[model samples]
Target: MEKQDVTANEENDLDDVANSSTGNLVDWDGADDLAKPMNWPNTRKAKNIVVICYLTFLTPLGSTMFAPAIADVMGTFHSWDPLLASFVVSVWVLGYFFGPLFLGPCSELYGRLPVYLICNVLFMAFNIACAVAPNLSALIVFRFLAGTFGGCPITIGAGTFGDLIKPENRGKIIAVWSLGPLMGPILGPIAGGYVGQSIGWRWICWILAIASGVGAVASFICQEETYPAVLLERKVRRLKKETGNENLRTALNVDRKASHVFGRSIIRPLRMLFLSPIVGSLSLYQGFVYGYLYLLFTTFPLVFQNRYHFNTGTIGLTYLGMGVGSLIGLGVGGVVSDRLLTKLSARSGEKKPEYRLPPLIPSCFFLPIGLFWYGWAAQANAHWIVPILGTVCIGIGVNMVMMCVATYLIDAHPSFEASATAASTATRSLIGALVPLAGRSMYEKLGLGWGNSLLGFMALAMCPLPWVFWKYGERIRTSPRFQMKL
Candidate 1:
């Protein structure tokens, strides 16, 4: 009887331990789960990235796919001034500047998927409103609103991938995703030009709405919630039910006394703008470059239409130079960035963001050289191909710089990836919005030759600035506001 009692106690002890282990497993209430995102199946993760990219592509298509219709709208609405008409072309970018201030932080509060769905619906509705707009004022307002809503994808898309992919492998995925936004301006004009001339300016809007509507449906079906905080909250809800523990909660769900109120969180970006030099410098540098690129885009039709006497259809073809150039640049930039990371990893005993700057050096030189070549060639009324080739060079340089800037920002500010990107987008949008307004007037005063040369000279001055930062970037990144060590 004594021996039997001892054996029973041993069995009971084993049962107790097992039950305790199971209980602990169910207590994910406050613990981090490695298996959450990091453990997601590779195939499922890849599919998610693809779906996100698709949703992202539709947003920009809404932004610029109406480019070819600018002239038609101006005439339809009886607007006489070209400057007034350019607003139709560039106002979307203005909205882009403002959209991120709200859309970005709100995504962090909710989740990427919810933010994406809501913004896209707004984008599509405004897009439809733009198509049927009866007057210039109404049209501009709708276009601006559409751009604000459309801002969600560009601001959040890169970070969404970061939430899913690790740093080591994210370079290639980012490279692929970057093409959609970069290529949209080029592709938009081609399709928009023909559609505007063939059908009506309104059809351009209709076409974008149809395409975006389809994308919206696909996004709703494919995109699951990706934010960790949001996902953790869901997990907490599930465990509360399973264990019947009313106290079960996640760190993300509970508001700490230390947490910022809604007002503070809302104004953080403005504070970040004034308080952070890194944000200011990067925004200025990237913004200027982006603005110059769009300035050239808005002015291209004028160059071809007036000098070469090309029809609108033919003028739109010039955008192909930009498309081809961007592809080449992105391809080269991706390869160079990855290789530099590997080399720096070996030298520093770890990867660092400084390595990403080497490819940028050559690209910087190309910017000025291409600008001068394009200006003088167009001025001399040289063969059309001369200007076309120069545009290609500009395209290559622009894409390289953009890709480098984007990757550097994301690498440096992993925790604030969304905000950093939002800052960048807002910067670019402001420049994009402002540049085209001055395009015609600038061209008239300086002529194509001098005006473009002036632009090229400006690009030359800023080209070397990136290298300065690359060398001493670590010191600058040490700022608490910027938090570069991430």
Candidate 2:
């Protein structure tokens, strides 16, 4: 009898261990799981997007908000070097290049909310530091730090949308979110020109700091953790405590050490950048477009002030052409792209990422035409409206192309959208940062006509890229050679 009783107890213990060790994985309860970000209420998602868009806007705004003040900053510092003046503006964009490399991966590994909150606070602090800096070197350093922290939103904002919205409905939200990054730079000079001319360059930094503080507060109140892995992990922890299941685990590798996950996560964007042909090609094209955009930004005040004989304040107003063009692009691109995707998907009975490329075909033409028009018009001293009209075309082209590429990247990578975006951001930003430093020299040596012609020719040459991608993207994306192991 005693032996039989001991046997029964041992069997029961073995059964409990078996139950704990196997088939104990935790996941969303079902498709309707309200805890999942995708199933979150519309109000909740809208609030999060608002906070994200606000932060994204402020960061890029910080990148160039003081651009109109660059001359003043140089004068105040007793520095006449044009390169140094450009560097002060470009260095912030350089920070955009580096910050996304690590921050995007960190959000994937740890969670989005903590990273967002922490970066927001630090962003505000560094902006304040910029406002208080005593010297040019100190101000540059502070600005770079501010930019690095400010990059958190630009890096992770799309991922948040991916968390909440289905791919079919993503284009609209992305278009709305993109307005922040696209318009912020265009509007920056407009505001900075007036502020710098009236109040002095230092006030630009002060205003940015104040705006950043408000963004930080909004983030704390509205942002929530949207990363699926993080949410599942939290649910697993609750279940483990409630049911006393020691071996319960989330589908994501919750048991892995944070360091190990982070180490792998940090390398992902680089891997995607180098190994994935789709990402590499699109990023290179995007980088070229971005380079020219900044080239224009840096040289605009010089071009308008010298050729059009405009003052600092009016020089800033010239950007309004690009601003209006961007709005049109955003509206048309968002609506058309989504409708195209849906229409194409219905015809084929399946959605393809390449559907997003249709808009790029027309946009490619817009870029070169605008570049040539603006360049020659400005060189010939045509009506100011002519060059501004050219800027409108350039604006429409840039925004549409960027929007298409961004949406395609998100769709192609699916769960890896953040890492994919980080790769693209890193490349474009590196080019964006470096291109402007040479803008002054390029226009001086080649003159506006040939300098812009050079850019126009390049744009013309690359016009076939979108068509090529639309034809072959699926094959390239599926090719083992282009696959990222991570």
Candidate 3:
């Protein structure tokens, strides 16, 4: 009888071990019986995404919504120089570069939800300070702080999505996810141009605050803890309650000395920056393109207002080309990237994350072509549509390039997705912040035609980077620094 009982207990123990391991590996699918996010009805998930999208929208809108109103701000504040005014737009990006170094690590330690909520509130408060600033210096200071706070969500949003969605379906889901960030810049200047021209620049800040507040409430209700370690901890707690097994803990989280160490939190993002060549090279290339794009962004109002004789609202409407082009590019690229991945996997006889680069090759050529057209047309004062058409191409090219880089980086380094993204953001934002200050000086000295031609030349030079990278990416990724085991 004793021998029979021992065998039965051993069998039950094996079953329990199997169940625990299986639970950990089961990819999160919102529709699955055990899927936490899927447990919410379809309507609920849609609502959550919409709310998160809206929240995401406010960050970029806050970044550039004030751009169209810069002339008014200069006159109102009695500032004489345009370059100084450009700083107002570019400074936000400066925050974008630095904020992630700290915020990315902090989110990993504290969990995504708490950090997300706290930072959104801080963003709202500081943005309001920008609206009510007593002087230009104060406004600049407030804007910087607001941007630093706003930076948290952009990083956290990526992690939050991973928590909610499974890897198998994430490609399509991420396409929808791209919409929010893309739409914000489009919607921002349109509304901002009208609002700032009619009401005041302060209203731009008020509008952002209101929109962000709504997003915060929605997140509080719908956004749950998605990190697996966090989720497992909750599961352990629940099991302890149900079966009174206090020892029921996840093996993945052993609470080692390194786990509790705070120093790694500060060092890890920087370490990844130096150690990951894939992260470094991709970040550098993307950063320059992003910076050039923003440099153009800061220059747009001046080009239209002074050169084309457009009013503020009309100047804002011109950005519609950029917005429309981005949407078209995103749709086309999303389809092509997925198809390319499927085909490459079949042909290579093994899946490689580097196969994703082929779809991005066209953008390298298109970007330079668009730059030349946009630069020369705007400089020559060709009919407005010609310049807008060029800008449309630029937008499309940028969207595709961004989508490819973002997807590749995430796919290549899944274990360190947040850190990889942070590295990219750091490089991109630093360039975005610095490029605009030179716009005024460059355009003024060279005249619009040659000044823009100079920009075109730079884009033309960069055209080969994506193609070379795409062909050699497999070899490059094989290096120890980029040796992603994915």
Best by TM-score: 2
Q: Residue by residue across 1-486, what tens digits does model 2's lDDT show? A: 435643554344334334543657766655766667897778878899999999998898888877777899988889999999998998898888889867876787789999999999999999888888889999999988898899999988888899899888989888888888789989999999999999988888889989999999999999999999888777667666766877777766643466765566567777887888788888988888888888898889889888878877777888889889889999999999899999999999999999998988887788899999999999999999999999999998888878899999999988578778988999999999999999999999999988999999998888988989899989988877666364
Clash numbers, per candidate: 0, 0, 1
Worst 10-residue lDDT window for candidate 3 reads 24-33
lDDT per residue for candidate 1 within 1-486, as digits (tens), equals 435643554444323323644332222212233335544567757767776676566666555655556777888988878887777878888888888766766767777788888887887798899989989999999999988887777878877877777777667777777777677777788887788888887988898888778777777877777777667666556555655656645544434222342334345555555556655676777787788777877888888888888776777788888788889988888777887888788988977776777788778777777788888898899999999899888888888877888888788767567667777788788998898899899989998888888888988888877788788777777765455222
Show where candidate 1 strays beyond 4 Å: 1-35, 251-266, 479-486
The alpha-carbon lDDT assigned to residue 288 of candidate 2 equals 86
Candidate 2 error regions (>4 Å): 1-22, 254-256, 484-486
The lDDT of model 2 is 0.85
Ranking by TM-score: 2, 1, 3
Ranking of candidates on lDDT, top first: 2, 1, 3
Cα RMSD to the true fold for all candidates: 6.8, 6.9, 5.9
- Candidate 2 residue pairs in clash (backbone atoms < 3 Å): none
- Model 1, global lDDT: 0.74
Tell me the whole-model lDDT of each prediction, alpha carbons only. 0.74, 0.85, 0.73
Query: Candidate 2 vs. truth: CA RMSD?
Result: 6.9
